[model samples]
Target chain A: MLEGTMTSTTEITHLTFDVLVDLLRKIFVRHGVSETTAAILADNCARAERDGSFSHGIFRVPGYISTLKSGWVDGKAQPVIEDDGAALIRVDARNGFTLAASALARPTLLERAREQGVGVLAIRNSHHFSALWPDVEPFADEGLVALSFVNSMAVVVPPGGKKAIFGTNPVAFAAPRAGQPPYVFDQSSSAIANGDVQIAAREGHSLREGAGVDRDGNPTTDPRAVLDGGALLPFGGYKGASIALMVEILAAALTGGNFSREVDWSQHPGAQTPCTGQLFIVIDPARGGNGHFAERVAEICDLTREAGQERLPSDRRFRTRAETARTGIPIKAKDMALLQELVSE
Target chain B: MLEGTMTSTTEITHLTFDVLVDLLRKIFVRHGVSETTAAILADNCARAERDGSFSHGIFRVPGYISTLKSGWVDGKAQPVIEDDGAALIRVDARNGFTLAASALARPTLLERAREQGVGVLAIRNSHHFSALWPDVEPFADEGLVALSFVNSMAVVVPPGGKKAIFGTNPVAFAAPRAGQPPYVFDQSSSAIANGDVQIAAREGHSLREGAGVDRDGNPTTDPRAVLDGGALLPFGGYKGASIALMVEILAAALTGGNFSREVDWSQHPGAQTPCTGQLFIVIDPARGGNGHFAERVAEICDLTREAGQERLPSDRRFRTRAETARTGIPIKAKDMALLQELVSE
Candidate 1:
């Protein structure tokens, strides 16, 4: 709650998604990318906004292009599948974009599930994924329960032994229903995700309270302190820390990818220790005699909604997508200016 | 932490587990349970203590036996497989002891996983099991990844809502490895499990600081008030509540069991409710590339161990299990006296 930076007359505006995405694709193409990569990047940028993850949308494109041009990411490198068979697959991103690798892995897992009734894929040496829900939606749409987890560079300290030792690992879960929004819960174990802090910094805002500690391990309210050596606090302290640890093991540890201490130290720039490791699991219901697992899932959804919670986990995003498709994208004036400048290349 | 009566003692010894179980079994047998049911009851009582979960161990038997005699629990009843098949299972616990039913479900899940590579079981209308780790360990030992969750009477309140709307849902996760104990982490989303509060109360000690709140939402150090109308604060506030909600859906909602406002309002003597639900999932490594999965998992374990944290997630449980096996069971002074009394009966 304390993390948003204040804005006065910077003048935020709402632009249609297509208009904005086209603008982004143009900029990415100008920055030296193949059409394929540019489209994915555009989708990554647009999808986040459409999904209400504006912080990871076009606001990040300037920085992304800078990194791409500086060789922190390859616009043309192809991700290599390290291993494949049965119900599992592993992919190496070859220092290429993670969205590319993540986008690449989701379908692979789904395909495996189609054949084997379950699927798992891990990715290492990849770029950062904007939001986990996007990567998992495709699977859920195919009538599967999907779970996703990713470990970031260390920003939060471990439980007792001090000093930062793990990242604000994020977890995304979705269960499909026949005629309703899936029960969706996506969360980061940290009090506030790292991207929130980065966004605050970009907007010149302050950090949320209890979100992080100063370099001294003493709690602080400053956003900059969190972005620096100051450690981010776990969501519910120990329980949150435990979840982060679980995600770290599953995403980084089990995936043969980088853990907290081993991750890239690249907050500002440089050849980062390939931001690595993620897990995608898809479970099919028809095998269990649950006669249309999705139908039962719909029943459960009705109960939750009746309890006064929202009906659809992804309803807001889905609505936004439908609206954006019909109307347009929402882009702020400053972001629009930046997009134009970056594309003038 | 101040949610229960409290007393303090110097230190407990290995006699604690066996002594407590002996008393609990006698109490259950005296309350009209068959000898086998008594043993199962005793096993749960002792397992909780052996695993350092004294809160659920013998400390609970007296009240549980009283509840059973009052017909709050079906002492002579058995779990019936209301539904079953390939990848899924649904058990009608028939109001039988949750421990016994869960114990019964473990092997079934493992057997199914052995054949299908993945298995799931949902149980409803059951009593509370002492702990979940004991439930999932067998599957882990069988070279499968296992996870189980249970929803109890409301303990954790949802965010932005004053009413208690979710349980301090407990989750247990276990995975197999080459040698050593299976990696396991059993946890409650609350700051301190409600059961832990009861233990502190009996020990005549004050609850730990910052553990819970009294009814007015004001911080308090009174155990009775904290447990009475006051609610248990989740481990990480909103994040903890979020997880409680997640489990509420997955374990209770999915199981078609009572949840949230639906649980029987009585955990004490002379009280009963139809409130209960649990879910168990097991994945076999053999079909999912078990060999490579194990190797990758081993590497991850190595990374955690090498980090030199006092103990990785499962270290304490592993150490305790080893010590128990070598030196017999652990017991406390008061518990031993209680056990002696029960044995005499």
Candidate 2:
């Protein structure tokens, strides 16, 4: 489905998901990430690619490599888990990637949810730069519901505000459904995602109305203007702004990590990752004694579709995942060359 | 600030909060509600009025009286709590007001949050017809973070769909702030709240663009059309629709309550309330070991305002509350007459 001709006759390269993960893992390890952390990061990025989340896939590798080379993030840092035998578990990522920290704490989080009926995982001092769905979907796979929030570097302004004080904060939710993959959604509080803005700027495409403001804080459609000292607006105006604020509180304040505005990578010129925090809340649906939880989810989903919502959130991604599983993940030949070059650098 | 001359002569009545609550309680009791349930509902409604949330306040009294007269909801049904000695607590509201069930379960919920670091309250078979802020704000006042979701009758449709299949589902959140009132926000996933639409319809006002659809599922700004066989649209297009879906899953599916689509109130002619479910997830921020959780929350709020946001969610309500405490809650003279009539009915 992703097959497309690049220039006049340039062909698209297709690779198995495993092959893509292995290739990306080499790039990460070469950029100073430990083998363990590289595997996790590579798998996450590859999964995004395999699921047609191209913005967060290989499109983000250069940022990862740049941030690592700038010494802003500790690619080899070991995360320390702080659990007081409570349902809430805290992890100090020690300036490492959030994926690694969450990976390390997953078992404890699952145990807490199963035993206590609900569990919360708070990770601090970590850099998060990928789609949040990859973090929460696995819990739903285990028959539990999960929600995750992550705050990024400030690139959004409050309504009618000129100064940027909020991030493109995203909240993701996942719930199991009967006879199907989990229902998942990862959406940014901003009208448009930063990755999408970057892609728009690269492709010289205009943004939608209400998507962003230029440097002067006036609404603008030029993606380049939005990238150069401009900022994004929250989705749905004030309602969406409130959500962005909530994400900051949940992921940053509650987790004891830096707020989006506090992320300053000025000294590290090439640093692109936001060193903030992330929070996860997982609940065991069985605790509610609702034996038909998954079936109910499926029912609502089917009803939504029947009601004329042509596509539900994650529908396209799941469909793409299946198609790619058979046809292999499609990538531009030039991008493939960049990955090969990244492996050596 | 609420004082205004009606018809150029009619005066606005002012009453202390306690006086308003007492009047409302009498009204509820006269309409067949038990004394205990009446007191709880009265306080909630009065609080909304005192805080200038008119939609869920005195404005709803007539609907309550009508529903009571129709014998739609059990005015004195006793809610039963089901405990499994886990962090999750289920409360069968027994077809009664949700307020009573939540009040009955508050102590246990608080205890669970304190002990387990997180608590989940699932209330099913309950009628919720008021502002959600009143439900979660107190948790923040107690220095905990709380989130609540409630689904109502199907007065909203999925984006671009003709049929009404979703409710104006609302999600409320609260968190304590340093040296200030708790930060709270209650927002409907719909573009505009159902209550607001009702108010607009009564006040002869037009809805904002994208607020709703007409009986034929065509975009409309007419309040009456939105009220009669039409439906509200989700805010922010697909993103808001996703939130509505999540609320359904969290509030109904997980709580073992009826989905919004399943609410069949045709037999109960005057039923204005949706007998569905409500979910509350409360967390002790201190459990994250973030000693300055409240202080951090305060910092971010201040920054948001300084960045040029004129007001944050619940700002007007909090300000109005303080003002009312100093002076009195302002009520239209006509509404006072209606209250008097309700007391004798």
Candidate 3:
């Protein structure tokens, strides 16, 4: 159910996850991106599928190609370290792609932590490429604790207000455990991201009630209601607002970038704003060099797991990725059609 | 109007807030505390009053005195720094009080931040003594961004489960600004804290519908039902659960102390746990010699204030504190009665 002149005449095809990722990588390489950069973007998309986060997956391939074609994202842009002292770093993304640059810049933070005890990375002036979970996963995969946040364009409304004054303000935190998957928690402060709403609209699905509101501040399930400057509701009212504010401070304020309302990442073709920021903090357990550290972490997570039936956080996703590596990735007809058109083009 | 507890037997003459605080300080000294430590505890209580947090104010004097007489907390015990580095410091509270020790230890953190750009202070074997905002406001006043959290006894249910597996874990963050007050946001990650439920119970008032659940996982408005082995829902469902989990890891895991299921700060004798942990992190905006950092924080607060009519975080309490300083402090009759007994003793 997307209305208006949004029409489709594309063909549909089902491709395996690896083949699709390879195809997407080739497309990114053809656009002048370096090999590492292309792989990072492609890996991000594949990980999105693995995590069941399709909104940020190959679903966005068409948009990515168009964004690059419009010169909104630089293919050859590089990130330069502006400051690295006292467990802090300021990285200039050079208007490059965010996922690629974040992938490149995150290890520098870990390197600092290896030398010292803790490290922080702040990236400025970057473009969106894919899901943020992949950016912080490696830190947890190693023996480190990590917290990362990215501030996007304004999509969520403040508490007791109707205006869209904050992005979904995505946040993710991960901690390592010995002999088990890391406990990774990631979420958007809003009930749902506007990107998800767009995906639903594209796939002709009705959105859940209370997920969004109309331009006049009336609650609506119609994705179109939230797209045209209508506000997205934050999850859990005041607490959600507090989280949104926290993300603003970490991702936008501390990093010296645009606040929520000043940035533009809407799906529209003409919108342009270059002021985005992100913060990544990594703490190495070995830097502190405690012997009983991993044991205690395992104890806590084991106690929690015994308290319930759920597996460790991201365990399901890790298992799913393994299964998807064996089987083909399931895709919606609409998404298949769009990817096919992109592959042909 | 409290239904059952408002009686002449519990009423006492009104005393100035300063007089009440002086009485508590004198008692602390009598129970084997130094004058300096006594003053810090009393001063923290007094500042809580100024910050308009009555529940964390002098109302807890009897509990402090009871714990002292019972010997669950050591009055003369002092915190020793067990480990020290530029980025991290671990302190053992020696079964002593947390308030005075924490207040005495925070300065060391700020001092370390002067050299290291960031500082962390972790305390184990401490007691809960005062409001969170009081502990963090000093850092903000000194132009540093501060965040702190403590894990309490299990009273909150984790997401998707009915068991009381998480505490009403509270995390507080304060950001400094030149023109406006430090934007302080302190909240318990529970639909309702036990303190609020106690107030409702004493007042014979029905609880909020969704605040707590009865023992059988059924929602109830009965405060007593929540207090007696029942669970308070996590604030914002999965978001609150995630936040509580974050606090647990950052505070307990980082500090190597007991977590939610292990914390016990109750005043009841023979039922407490000496396994409390606290985490404090301070970031110096002056580390980079960024002179405009404070004012930039002010700009963020101003934009938030301008964005809506809702008071900027912690605005009303600050105004209340100013009013109390100008006029006289306000105290409930039941609280005054307890204060009178303590002063008389």
Candidate 4:
């Protein structure tokens, strides 16, 4: 088992999926969350951990607890979906977890895409705390092309600016292949993800050049400089900055939610929610007719693999998913202790 | 007036819009292209030149003529649009320019989006010349969000492979604003466009580090090394590579067109057509009811400007467009000579 924290005397544990989900569900339920909401949160967290997204997995428990306790998130809130049309939907998340909100709207969303050839869903007043792939993968599994964009708290400095004016906004796209795992990808527009920098600082590692900048806007490789008031740079310079702007508009502006800078975190104090907006698009590829969509997707995958270079987008996640399913999830001893304390309280 | 090359004498020449289009049309028609096809080609090239896209403008005419003469492109071909449903269309470009095909498909595509909230159009068996902005900009101008992706001949080496397996696949996105020029962006997934590299090689300029690699897959800054047998690297590493794959799947795979490697230039001899596939998507933002779609797009622009930093996408395009409209377009000495020779022939 991996070591957790230096002060932890407890030994790390390997827990089965059922055990982990049970613990997560108990923790949320004890804290006033509805059984259904708790189950969704538990399943999302478990899947993140199982898929090796450590940042979004059990690592996020503390943050979720903080937000729920501070009234920033409604533990028992039920997201309501308004079907504006055959192809358009809006989910009023009621300041609930995006996981729960997306889950609530997914059935009708998928049905709409199947019938209409395309479906657009706008999610507002939600806190997105997990990886995006989990949200889009289900659609791909159903033989649809899916895209998602979400805008978060501002931490990136747009090109030509010295101050942070945009979020490390992220976009995701997924396409399905017959008899194979779908091609899926999610990426932040920032030069480096915030979690990555935090990990680098924890490991006492210097960042790659151009990852971020100091308070004065001079580039720095020091993770501390970036975390302590500095800002991350947009990836690929202005191209990435433009994409970040697109996401901000698509997610925040189109959803009638707060922009990255518009969210007042000072009011929430230490307990903060992303309080973000998200856009999810689903397209029925068959709508364009059976125009060799499956074959083309397969050809791309075969070419990538046959080239003997570059792993397919979902390769790692699928591998880790299998491993985690076969064995179990490993929880650091210190993290388990922290969860145990919450359970007792 | 710009200059024209005469070996012994170089004379500058400035041509108004009417003059350029007339010259281009005459040249193409002289090469056996139908008058209608020639006019479309001329209008697209003239617009590209006016917008400062030298690579796609007059620089591309010789290639178009070569393809027409070789019979690889049917100069008189008419693209047929098959409207399978209210939300989907497939355009059989009939071995003609994508510009002509898109023009033929634009009206129905826009109408479908306005009625159904979304529209998907796939163009197959077409040669895409000129910048992508012209295709998507019109949709944005009509108050829709437009996205286009096209895959060309492979020149970019996927990460971890020395051989080129992908094209300089480009994706363009445009969002309309109420009264301002739309937010528009077009980008190739390669570290540098092939044209840029060739120009650098001719100008004896070194490429930026990580732009491409030598034949052995070793990184190099020498443009000649990259232009010769070496291959261009995808921008932003794997993220860009993934996007390139997405474009390949959506364009080539979904459209049932040839993949990058599938196109054999040897068969066509001197005349080469991109002979590529393109996917276009148009979304009606108003479908997101009460989302303040136009206001949000405008807010994004206003915020970017009021933040006291950064040039918004399409800012330069608008400025250049206005200036070119007033002063006309200037052709370089050598390029002007080439055009004159084509016209005279």
Calculate the i-RMS of every candidate, to one decimal place. Answer: 4.4, 0.8, 2.4, 2.0
DockQ of each model vs. true complex? 0.22, 0.81, 0.37, 0.53
DockQ of 4: 0.53
Off by over 4 Å in 3: A1-20, A264-275, A285-289, A308-315, A331-337, A340-344, B1-20, B31-34, B264-274, B289-291
lDDT of each: 0.68, 0.93, 0.71, 0.81
Clashing residue pairs, candidate 4?
B1-B13, B2-B12, B2-B13, B3-B11, B3-B12, B3-B333, B4-B11
Using DockQ as the measure, name the better of candidate 3 and candidate 4: 4
Worst 10 residues of 1 chain A by lDDT: A1-10
In candidate 3, what are the lDDT values of residues B181-254, reduced to their tens digit? 78788788888766678768877888876788888877889988988877888777767777777777776777
Question: Candidate order by lDDT, highest to lowest?
Answer: 2, 4, 3, 1
Q: Record all residue pairs in model 3 with backbone atoms less than 3 Å apart, i.e. clashing.
A: A1-A204
User: Which candidate has the highest TM-score of all?
Assistant: 2
Off by over 4 Å in 2: A1-10, B1-10
lDDT of 4 by residue, B1-345 (tens): 323212232554667877888899999999988888899889888888878877778878887888887777888889989886657688999888887888888889888788777888889898886678887888888888888999888778888888887888888989888778888888888988877887788789999998998888889999999877888899988878888888898788877777776777676776667787899988887775764777788887787676545587688878888887776676677878898899989
Indicate the residue-level lDDT of A199 in model 3: 83
Pick by TM-score: 2 or 4, better one:
2
Q: After superposition on all CA atoms, what RMSD does each candidate show versus the true structure?
A: 6.4, 3.1, 5.5, 3.7
Give candidate 4 regions above 4 Å deviation.
Answer: A1-10, B1-11, B305-309
Candidate 3 residue-wise lDDT, A232-311, digit = tens: 88887777777787778767677766677776545446433234788787766544435555566776677656655265
